[model samples]
Target: MDSGETKISLKDAENEEKEQFKLLHKYEAEVPKTFEEAISETGFGRFNYTLLVVILFPCATQMVETVGMTYIVPVAECDLHLTIEDKGLLNGVTFAGMISSGLFWGYLCDALGRKKIIVYGYLVTGFFSVMAAMSTSKGMLMGAKFMSGLIMHLSKSKAVLIPIIIFFLFVEFHAWNVFMLICASMTIISGILYMFLPESPKYLMSMGRNRAALVVMRKVYSKNTGKPQEDFPVKKLVNEAKQNFTSSRVEMATALKSGWEEMKTILHRPHINNMILASFNAFSIVMSLNTLKFWLPGIFQSISDYQNNHNGTSSSMCVMLGEMSKPKNITSSQECSVVKFHAWNVFMLICASMTIISGILYMFLPESPKYLMSMGRNRAALVVMRKVYSKNTGNPQEDFPVKKLVNEAKQNFTSSRVEMATALKSGWEEMKTILHRPHINNMILASFNAFSVVMRQVFSSLLVILTFISATCMFCIYFARSSLAVTILSAAGTAVGSVPENLLLTITLELFPTTLRTIALSIHLTAQRFGTTLGNAIFPYLVQMGCLPPFLFIGIFASATGLLSMLYANTENKPLI
Candidate 1:
């Protein structure tokens, strides 16, 4: 299967995407895609931690924006004369832009590139933060905040934005204390830094721009340590390129069409019900969790009974305002006491910790490579497989599906090796093809990947109300002078909700194709932006209103949504690799 002489068969049975088997069966397998091979081929090298730093820099900005918004609740309540409903509207409306733009950014990342958009997203988000922070009017502030997310979504979460945004969404409304100024400052720094990182190497290679991929890889490795790459999988790739010979120069329009076709095919399949279930379940969790995220401040405010504690002498809002006006030692001192909304801070801390634990869970779950390979991006698939395998073996490329691997393994055995070696290799290759079999005439994995995001979006709208109500109830508990009750209940609910959010990552693994892992990642992130925009923006207003007298309606919403969440598919047991 030399690149020059590779053959392809697209018989109606194969290209039609029909499932001839009763189940999708897979055994352990491995290969090397661009990034892993680039790293591995440079065998003597240390990991490129520098690039990781670059990749993670945007998080600083995200955290800043989040902290700035969530921590400033008391201050915001006073300065803008914000009603509870106004607060909810501010949170929800600000995020409104995200829903419309997420898919576009993801598609752009796939078509045009990654680094440029990411840089653009970071800088834009930073500029908006500054605008939002300095605003004098609620409308202006909301506009600025919404614009910030819209701008920041330029990079999405494929890199730095992921952790930062997640932190704020899950933590800001509930934490004990955080330095908003420092967080804001960090975001500005990251926006400036993102302008410098190179594109993901795997992205370039899949586009048939090997020279660009090679350049980025060399720089990444060189930054780690000076070394020449060796034991490369050059022959393997050359053969793969031959086998997967779709036109390298396919127009962006056509590629987009193919991507859409792949997306629709999944939604229409028999298992499509799973996609619906996944969406609703995810939505339910998001709605309920955001209940805590968007309104924890109000909930904490009610429960603090600070007035009763100090004989109702001074409002915490006024106290916070005094601290903000003076710019006097806000980080570690008596100054923060005025703004200490104890109940809110405690809930935020609980949720934040839960979010951290969930991220760690992703290690046990491999990103789904089936989606990528199904999308005709085999090179990227191999790269992902290598990562999955390396975790399992010191030598991961031995069982690669290429013929060269089989022949080499045979020769090394001196043919004295039982013919079982060839039989084993042949059986493995056959299974690989079967798992890849077309379904309803479309790439099943790719369909699953696309639907995963769409499902998320669908349920997000429904759950937005759910989150609003839950937080509102917690606020009522706070008002009842039952701070402990509110704290314990909110914490328990958040811990449970956190596991469902992990579905975000899990769903990404379900549908993303191996060849376009980075690209698909970018798209899924955009889908996340969709959730953040609509939910986070409107979130503040919803909870704030519920915080007002008689917020029982909010509690009903959360309870109802939680029950609904139980209806979605349990992707917890999904197999990844």
Candidate 2:
């Protein structure tokens, strides 16, 4: 062969190999994968634990905001000389505030960033809360309470403050003013702690900040395992970033436009129906729980007074060092004196303190990687995975399932412009998709569940009242008084009935795609606030209409909710969109 022919032959061979490699890369990119698949290899570790811990404060604070009023009215009655109207206003005002602002915060969480809303929201909530504590007039107190609810945006979670609420009711510490101050302090503490937490990686990537996401992952890994950033998977992250980072530049206006459209999407298709159902369910749960909670102190006070009168144990009217008067009873036409209990005040203080501690603990956790992946920042997701893998497996990022995760994310690699346009357009299309055939069935099921949950809450409250009435009947029949028995049973029954209430949040989170999750939740919570306010406002009227009608009304709703469960979508083990 001639030298010229040999050189030409070599060049052709090299070119062919290069083309083959490109073809191979394209083929591998088509393989389907998910964020969960990538993250699963990381194993649950310090990252998750810390995240859970940090989230606990927001959860606790939320509970305090919703249920705290129950404790406050009883303790503050003496100092503030509260009227029944004033107490009712206080109970509903926080929820009213939340309902009004929930959409605003939810929009921001989806548009700008989750961390920003959370940090600033809590700080402002704290400031208003302090103003509420220092108020001397009912009008000032009501205004402060309204403002507190307006600015605060709380995260949803279960099992944070239930035990505290129950426990504080039994302790005696007369300090309502101090407790209010403490609740305010917790809000401030959570805001400060949140400042240290990482922004959601999904949010960062969606903004085209791949390098920043990688840096956060390294920081998390170093903190968890005492491992240096040098050992982190820089190469794999960079490669993954190449596949995921869609636009070299994500315009602020474009991103905002996209977010506004995404927010609109939840109100519209497959998402809209589910979103409606979830919101209704939220309405039911919050309304029922708050209605019962706010009404309890008043009912118990009446019960204690009635029992004391019949038993010939004159309830204390003057403040004694160790003695507590039975709760005062008030009728619409009768004038009532201020009544206070030390134990109830102390309970409020303890709950506020615990919430503060929870905020402090939450300061250590990382942002959710699932959120990061959704924003199209696959590299940032990789960094989080490496941290999880290093902490759990005691291995370097190289040993983690980087290839699997990268491959999965690469499978859905649409260009930035196309992706944004699709998201914007998706609002109407997704709603249309949901309205069609099988998906619509799920929406029907969700609606039924929501109605049932709301109705059942009413029933639960009535059941307690019925139990008391039954006990009263027994006492008259056999002269066998069991007031203590009735009280314990009612409290226990109410607590048990509320056990599954918060799971709605988790279920809603799982049911919706990441893009629509926050807005859906926000809508749900806003609906809940509306329900709570309505329930609290109307329960007095319902009671006036007669006890049996209220119970009957709730019974019908609960039955309907149970029947709808039969049509549920059976979403178990399904991959989130």
Q: Which one wins on lDDT?
A: 2
Query: What is model 1's C-alpha RMSD?
Result: 17.6
**Candidate 1 on 516-535: residue-level lDDT in tens?**
34444544444444444445
**Stretches of candidate 1 above 4 Å error?**
1-36, 43-47, 152-184, 228-252, 303-485, 504-577
Per-residue lDDT for 78-129 in model 2, tens only?
5566755566778888888877776556446655677888888887787677
- Highest-scoring model, TM-score: 2
lDDT against the true structure, per candidate, is 0.50, 0.59
RMSD of every prediction: 17.6, 16.6
lDDT of 2 at 380: 68
How close is every model to the real structure, measured as TM-score? 0.53, 0.56
